[model samples]
Target: MTLSFQRIAYEALNVCNGVTMAALEAAVERTGLAPGAAAIDIGTGNAAVAVRLAERFGLRVTAIEFDPVMADLARQRIDAAGAGAEVTLAVAGAADVLARSAPVDLIVALGTTNVTGEGRPTPEAGFTALRRKLRPGGWLLWGDIVWLAEPPAPLRQITEATNLYTDDAGWRAAATGAGFEVITGRISDPAEFEAYPRDAVTAVRAWLEAHPDAPEAASIRFHADRVQAITDFGRDYIGFGVYLLRNPD
Candidate 1:
């Protein structure tokens, strides 16, 4: 099977999501999650956060990633991290995976809520669906893009074409509407927002240089360039954050 452009572009990176490792660790720490807590990481690309949860906090994690390539990569990483025993890796959509697993103390869905297949056209709907799989008082480490300021029409149109994200206040309100209490959230800094796609582009460019004749090189470059463009033009208005939310008891 042909590898997806996304996989080609991001597989080499430790974490596919835009947030930095330090940022992720800080957000997780704020949750005050105890060792041995049960957690589920939905859309766990490369198992970065999943492995951290298992290795650092000793949490038992059910990590779900829909993309086959990503799932395989995650599995490899988990094994290499010696976290295979603590993490159960599933190659399935977040909704499907959650349906089959038991309720957990935490649910983490970062940058892939659409995997829930909720027809409702917003991340809030996805959050609502995932909330059902969380035990009462459980935490959710939700991460995605949001608008820092209302953008120009062109930028707004571009962003709305693919993402249903809103501003920070909107996200907090949506969480409340989805029966979650917003604990705290941290938005990505300008440096992080700039670095993520920059790094991906650099990696893809290096790969292309090494494999000039590869059939997939063009497609990978296209994706990398697209990401870079978005990062370049949208960084002013677009932002990413990890919001810690609690399912109210």
Candidate 2:
């Protein structure tokens, strides 16, 4: 895989323990989902968040992912983690999956919101989709990339227009539209921003050195530039944060 793709996937995966994980944990705790409360994880890549919710918080989880590969991976991981009974895997987009879901106690989208093809649908839009699937006072945990800087044209194009940029006010506005009250939100620490790229670069470099003749080596090297660009960008732009929203009565 290209370094950029790998980095993006890895970074998303890492969020399982970072801000996304913290946000989900907090949401679970704050919402006080009874031991049997149902929860859905949107864009549940690798379903790590879903498994975590069930295993840690004792909630029944339904994990929805758009990519078949990712959904399968999540299923495998959940099975291996012995959380299959607590988690269900579905291959579908968030907006679509939520459309079919009945009221639950919580909805979470971690790093998957940007791929929804609706322009990251402000928190308000996100909440609206989630609100339908969650009961009153239900919790919505959203994790997405926000602008750390005004991305240069080159970087923006290179990223294939997959980046999103939003501020606190912008997010709050969206949550209001979705019929939610913003409970708590915080940006990822600069340390996390710096560390992610640093680790991605490290992983890429090690792989390149070990497999210099691999067929995908060129592609990997080409995308290493993205890693460099992201590292440089994070110098100023704080890129991601987690927001917890609660449906109002």
Candidate 3:
């Protein structure tokens, strides 16, 4: 996707996954992070979650976004929220930030493609890397795609092209292997699952309709159609899951 359109698409979303903001708030509240605690929100597109962390949980947040364009937008969000260092923006890759970041009270990884580093991303790789970055008994709020069943080859190829994910059991096993106790997890409801991609595509369509003559309009539409097609087919075998995990004390 073109960088210009990518920004618009991201701006269209507050939460990348299918779950509602209320659901996320409930999960964060349950994590019991106290006021003035620290947090790092990786891949914080548009900084919605970061803002929420500060506004809702009263946590000091470092909002990380590797893309300069998205980071600019995120900066705008923080300013608009009239927040100070309560939510800081870190415009660096996840691995780079993790290398020097101090352990914090919480980590938010909602739809984050890479948590720990840049090597071929897997559930286990991400879980282990995160373990080293958390204080004992600290929390990790993870959200990502889950394969409900063995997906067909074509669908699998498309979904795994970016970051490798796994089934519900696999996610739990990986976290447990990395010494995290999986406190709880929730799978998206069927309607919720369908809405994620649908909304994304709708955002793109709305952009195209409004900017019919923009140079990148065709490219944007092409990518949007591809996304719509992929999700339409994989809906039966795929879902989004939010898991609350804790590093062992």
Q: Per-residue lDDT tens digits of candidate 1, residues 1-249?
A: 555556655666766777887777777787788999999988888888899888887899999888898787788888888898899998887777777777889987788756456643576777788788888888888888889998888877766764588899999988999899988888888887667677778877888888878888788777777777777788789988889999988
Candidate 3 residue pairs in clash (backbone atoms < 3 Å): none
Output the number of the lDDT-best candidate.
3
Model 1 lDDT at residue 4: 51
Q: In model 1, which runs have C-alpha deviations exceeding 4 angstroms?
A: 160-162
Candidate 3 lDDT over residue span 126-205, tens digit each: 98898788998899999998899999999999878878889999999999988899998999898987777787788889
TM-scores of the models, in the order given: 0.92, 0.82, 0.95
Model 3 regions lying over 4 Å from their true place: 1-3
Model 2 scores worst on lDDT over the 10 consecutive residues at 1-10
Q: Which of candidates 1 and 3 is the stronger one according to TM-score? A: 3
Badly placed stretches (over 4 Å) of model 2 are 1-4, 7-23, 114-123, 148-160
Q: Pick the candidate with the highest TM-score.
A: 3
- Model 1 misses residue 45 by how many Å? 1.2
User: Each candidate's lDDT (Cα)?
Assistant: 0.81, 0.69, 0.85
Predicted candidate 2 versus true structure: per-residue lDDT over 1-249, tens digit per residue: 233335334534544423536555776687777888898887776567788889888999988877765666677788889998899888877667776678888888766654334764544555576677778878888776665566666655644355444666677777787678888887778776566566666767777788889877788777776667756754664466778888877
Quick one: how many clashes does candidate 2 have?
5
Candidate 3 residue 122 Cα shift, in angstroms, is: 2.1
